[model samples]
Target: HSSMGEVWDEEMSSSMLGSRLRKVVQNYQAMNKYNVENTGPGGVASRPKLSGSELLCRLKSQVQVLTLTPDLQPFASLSWSSQLPVKSVTSELGPYKSCAVVSSAGSLRNSGLGKEIDSHDAVLRFNTAPTSGYEKDVGSKTTIRLINSQVMASDEHRFLSSSLYSNGVLVGWDPAPFSANLSQASWYNRTDYPIFTQYQRYRRLHPLQPFYILHPRFEWQLWQQIQDNMVEPIQKNPPSSGMLGTVVMMSLCEVVHVYEFLPSRRKTELCHYYQRFYDAACTLGAYHPLLYEKNLVKRMNQGTDQEIFTHGRVTLPGFSALNC
Candidate 1:
C-alpha cells in the first residue's frame, strides 16, 4: 500500500466508530487500491479526457443558482428578498493565461507567494480567510469568494456587515437532502440551515454585490464525480468548498494555479493560515473526502512535486482550454 493509504489505515482504525464498519470501509479501499495505477489520469473524464466543448458544457450546466422561496418564513424578521443581489451571477471571467487558487491552509503561513499569486489574472479565496493583514503571504486580490452555509447563517457580523465580502463575486452553497427536489420549495423545506433567509437579508443589505447560491444538484454532481474517480469509496459528504471553488475557477480561466491544495513540506497542523488552531485532519481531512480529492488533484496537476513541496503551487490546464 502507498504511504497515504497506510496513514489512512492507521487513522481510520483508531478514529472510526465501529469495527465492522471500519473493516468494510477498509476492504472497499483495498479492493480499489490497485484496480488502477496511480500514474493514470484522475477519475475526471476517463483516459482520453473530454473535448473542450463537452467539458465546458458539463461544467457550465452544473454551475447554477438555487431559486429562493418568495415568502420569508421562520426567520420572518429579516427583509430577505429585497436584500438579495441584483441578479444571479453570470460571469465568464475566463480564457485567461493564468489564475490562482489560494487555499486557507496553514501551510501557506510563510510562503512569500503574495506577488506571484497576485500576478494571476484572477484569484479565489474561501470562507472568511482574510487577506488584509496577511497580504504578504496570501495576497490582497479577491476575484471570488466561495463559502459554505455555515459562513452565511452563523456569523452575521462578519459575513453580513463586514466590508471584506463586499468587494468580490460571492458564491455560497447550502446542502440539501435530495438532489432531485432542489426547487425553491424543496430548498425551503430541506436545507441544512436557513441560509436562504440569511442570504436574502444579506442581499437586502448589499443589493449591488454579485451573490449567488449554488444549485444543490451541482454540488451533488461534483461529489458524485469525485467518488466515481476515487480508489476508495469516500465519506458521504459533498466535496469541500475549496474543491468546488477550484472547479469554478477552472471553467472561468485558461490555467488554474492552485496553491496549498496538496499542501507543502512546510505543511503544519493548523486548520487555516489566519487562525492558530492545529489538527493534522485539516490537511489530511476528517469530515471531508479530502484525501481522495487531494489524490485526484495531485494526479491532474501539471506541475512537479518540487514546486508543490517548496512553493505549495500546482498548475492545471483550465477546463475552458482542455481537450480531454
Candidate 2:
C-alpha cells in the first residue's frame, strides 16, 4: 500500500509544486477538519487497479448529481414549495451534445480560448467569474453558474443584484456536517454558511429565474467517491466548486470539456482571471481537496495531455455516454 507521503510525491512529480505549497497540503491532511474516517486499507490498494473505463463506470453508478427537489425537506415544509422548480436541473436544461466547464484559473487570462469556449452547446462557469472584459479568453456565454453558499450569503458579491449572477441557471451548494442526516433540521442547523436565508430572499426577488440548491448529500457522496479511489485520505472538506460543477455538467451533457481546472503550461500564481488575488491554494488546494480532485479528473480524461498543456482542457464523457 502507498503511504500518504508517497502519493503526494507522485503528485509533486507532475505538479512541480514548491515546498510551501507542499507544506500547505500536509497541514490540511493533518487537520482533516471535517473528521473523515477511512480506517480500512485504501480502495486502490485493497482491490485490483481499475482501468479508466472501469473508473468511469464506477463514477456513473456511484455518484448521483442531485439538486434540491421541492419534495425534499426544509424547502418542502417551508414556503419554498411553490418557488422551487418542478423539473430537475438535468430535465430543465440538459441533454446537450457538448458543454464547457470554465474554471476561473488565471492561466486562462491570455489563452485566447474565448471563441472555442463559446462554441459549446452550453457553458458552465463557477461563482462570480465574469465574462465581460476577459471574453477574449474566457468566453461570454453562461448556461449554468454553480456557486458555493458563501457566494450567495456574502454582501460583497451583491448576490441579489449583481448582473453577473442574473444570467444563467444558478445552483447553490453548501457544506453540511459530514455525518449529518439529509434532513431539514440537520441541514439547516449546520450549513457552512447561512445560504438558506439568502436563497429564499433571492427567490422572492427573481421569481422567474431557475435557481436550485444542490442536495447536501451530493457533495458528501462525491467526496466519498474521491476518497474511495485514492491511496490516502484527502482533506475532510468538500470538493471545490470546480469539481462539483464538472460532475453536474457530466450528468447533463454528452461530452464535457473542462478548462483550466487542470493547470496548463501557462499556470500562474493568480487565483482567478477576474480578480487581483494571488494564491496557489486556489489551484493546488488548501481548504478543498483540489489536488486529488484534479488527479481524479485527469484519470478519467479521454483527451490527450497535450490538450491539458495547451488549452488547459480535459475532456470527459458525460454519464449518459457511459454504457454502465
lDDT against the true structure, per candidate, is 0.67, 0.83
Q: Candidate 2 residues 1-324, lDDT tens each?
A: 522121111242213558888777767767855556652344346765567778889888888888777786666787757777776777778799999999999999999999999999999999989999999999999999999989999999999999999987899999886663667556676677888788889999988888987876778888887777777667778899999999999999999999988888778889999999998888888788888888788888898777887889899999999997
Q: In angstroms, what RMSD does candidate 1 have relative to the true structure?
A: 7.8
lDDT of candidate 1 over 184-292, digit per residue (tens): 4555566777777778778778877777666566666666555655434565566687788887777677889999888777778898999989866677655566666
Question: In candidate 2, where is summed lDDT lowest over 10 consecutive residues?
Answer: 2-11
Worst 10 residues of 1 by lDDT: 5-14
Model 2, position 150: C-alpha lDDT score: 91
Could you tell me how far off, in angstroms, the CA of residue 73 lies in candidate 1 after the best superposition?
17
**Which is the leading candidate under TM-score?**
2
